[model samples]
Target: MKTTRKILLSAGSVLVLLLTFYLVWANTGLGSETKQSLKIDATASYGDSSNKGNVVGIQAFVEPVDYASEANFRRKIRFYMEEAKKKNWLIPNKSIVVFPEYFGTWLVALQEKERIYSTPEIEEGMQTMVLRNAGRFLATFLKCPQDVQDKLKYSVFAMKAEVIARVYQDTFASLAKEYKVTIVGGSVLLPDPVVENGLLKTRGGLLYNTSVVFETDGTINPQLIKKAFPTADELGFICPVKPEAIPVFNTGAGKMGVLICADAWFSEAYQTLKSKSADFVITPSYSNGYGYWQQPWSGYSGSKTPEKAKADVGKISLGEAWVKYAMATRAKEEAGIKKGINVFLQGKLWNLGADGSTIVLSDSAHATPFVGKSALINLWL
Candidate 1:
């Protein structure tokens, strides 16, 4: 009887503690404004006759904000871009600045700052944010009527479709032109992403994980490679693109190819990209969770983990697998490319972990990793 009573008391205390924590979190305001800058590498490698000039990987954090719109993103980006400039990373007219996958996805936080930041879980924050913005969302929805399938799709996308679409387009386009530099502008989720006359557009409501490449003038086309394989965690929100092969992008820098995050994992993406005359590959990636870089690879994600892999695949550390499979084995062997560059997103958002450490892959497995709070890796083209 005494033992039963103690158990009951413990359970009750736990419940009270949870309730108190929730109440405090629910009542909190938005986080304060943060000033941030991206860390850049001093120099990558010198460009040879075959490849392009300097490829610079930028490590940055996207701060939670009440207004992460195009203008706002541009401002925040410029804050760090100034550092790159001061450090002479701009590289005159011959440089290209690269960022990581999902770098643009955090714009959703701006929609409901207090609720988004207060909750330590992204999925929960997004759900509540949807509710908090229901009225505004409904008003926005009525403007675009859809078929049954689109309606179902729109339900998933409606919360921040317009905001994401607008911000994704305007932010990078303006930056490429303003800075007069080529930018593999990271990636964003858009419903049915398309390029209409050298500009990106969205149709329907099913979302795709798409990355864009912008010339100094931000001219469209030879850009917009959609993620062919999205990890299991992404299945809830993203659709794989139908294009069998990625478009070979031609910038002043030379011909380039892109593989968004998980797509970079498979050898097929590399083989197909090389056929299009790509000299090197630019893979924009994101891996969440602290120390995931040092943790075991386990298996593929989303098909995702912390979850263990099946017996056949075996276990390895996450960082090791990335260096071996993602870069050395798949990219170098299958594609037969001389160089590959990767930039990873780094930041904290609710439950999301940003753990990709930036790397530069050469013809051999001798890759240089830039692991720091702020890191930069530069290679001469």
Candidate 2:
């Protein structure tokens, strides 16, 4: 009896050990599989020549609003993410880039507001005596450091940059965490604060117009160009950065090229991407409706009439610029078509072939409303 009991105990112990080993091995293998399947290598290239495989691009138009509201912004983003998740064409393993309109305005605004409220104006306003302070009210309420007040005046600009950064971070982080997709070429406005020279004591000095790039790893990439395009030594507009100047970074799954709205209008920018052997160019833009100049207006006689209009409305195309740029890029792949300098918006997605042939995978010309809501274009290569 004693020998039989010992034998049974030993066999039970060995069985328990085997079961533990199997569980550990299975869990470890499961982790490895998840990492391999879920993580995308965005830095992979399609070679130096014209793209050989399928390429996909998405243009998302974030609506324009006079003021920045975080709740509204978040809702809009959540809707887009849900839509992307639902789309059948969006591949879980493939790369995706989203172009958001006017991203810089929101970022700059948020920063400026934070700076302004940090001043002493809040305390001064609270301490005011209503009856006795009538004369001093304006002075006390308006009292701010001359330099500080000047800075506050442009707080709107600063808030724009801050909101943009927050939105990009939140949107990209959520989508990456939840959907496992990557966003490329997210936009931010860089402020150039005007600095007063110590000796000169002037009000305005340093101002900045910069577009920021966001990577998939929840970090912002360096500025593509310090000053994308400096204007009048005080303003910077969207301009093409040299391909060689762009620093190469892992985009998580596949290599991506970043471009702002105006940058897309320039051929040199596309050439730059081609030189870098980029697989896709992600473009973000803020475009107003096309026929602004031809919009109907009230006449001096107070009559609502088409005769009062300066130009024919139907003849003007608001989205012509985008169309032109798209066509030029497509034409580059055509055998006999000469390259044209004009920018076209040939709708959303175009697949460029090495044999100089092109296919329009998706076009949103008729589908997207002209009211500035966001739109998406997805294509498979």
Q: Which residue segments of model 1 deviate by more than 4 Å?
A: 1-51, 66-71, 136-158, 302-315, 366-372
User: lDDT values of the candidates?
Assistant: 0.67, 0.36
What digit string (tens of lDDT, one per residue) describes model 1 on residues 18-72? 8777656544554334444344434345335333466777666654552433455
Please report how far candidate 1 places residue 171 from its true position, in Å.
1.7
Assess every candidate by TM-score.
Answer: 0.78, 0.48
The model with the greatest TM-score is 1
Candidate 2's residue-wise lDDT over 1-381, tens digit each? 999999999999999998777555433311011111111111111212222222333333332221124544445455555655554433443445453434434432221122222223432312321212233334433442333333432333332333354555565555544544555434444333221221101122232334444343444444343233322212222222343454323454445555544444344555665666655444444433333312442221111223423353344343432443332343233211222211112111112100111112122221223322234444433
Q: Find the 10 residues in a row with the least total lDDT in model 2.
A: 30-39
Among these predicted structures, which one has the highest lDDT?
Answer: 1
